[model samples]
Target: MLFNSAESQTVNIYLDDSSTPAYSVAGCGRQNDNRGTVVLTSGKTGTVLVGVCSGENACALMSQAIDISPPSDNSCVGVVASSTAGGDTNSAYVILTWKATS
Candidate 1:
């Protein structure tokens, strides 16, 4: 899921080795929460790339490696990424969560 706080920006999400975004969310002006799911084999790992764009130009970029593992029973695991120092104004953040499905 992506939670974009920047009032006039857009957040783009990309999966490993992909040149195109897998998901995109407009800033608070349009939407606040955008969610998606990616399923990977157990013990598999990949990269997540994020682009914060102001119009057609990128204002900030972030990347991280992600490892998939089942969460505890009845619980979800989450990872968060924030742009800028202390997540100042015009910054965007993403929360990636993992949970086991029946």
Candidate 2:
């Protein structure tokens, strides 16, 4: 989750078995757990850490994302999720938090 603009270096740290970690929200800006991707904007650029949280926890989230830099805003993901239990439909409430460190 660190990016060095000086050398144009980027790193995304992933934990566990590729399953999104659930973060708890006790205060504000807690991760959203449902299923979705994030796209950075506003002239910002860097690595984005995607996190997902459960409905019963605070600051608890399961997150992961690709180290991508789209020339015209591309390499999108999770635009659709399983409405059921096996990713078979579109799942809403899936929020994504992104930080573009430039």
Which of the numbered candidates is closest to the native, going by highest TM-score?
Answer: 1
Best by lDDT: 1
List TM-score per model, in order.
Answer: 0.47, 0.22
Error of 1 at 11 (Å): 0.9
For candidate 2, write residues 1-102 as lDDT tens digits.
Answer: 211111111112223333332232211122223223333332222333444222322222333444456543434333111122223221223333444333
lDDT of 1: 0.53
Q: Can you write out model 1's per-residue Cα lDDT over 2-70, one digit (the tens) per residue?
A: 555554566666777778777766654325466455543223345666667655556654545455455
The CA lDDT at 91 in model 2 is 25
Report the alpha-carbon TM-score of model 2 versus the true structure. Answer: 0.22
* Residue 90's lDDT in candidate 1: 48
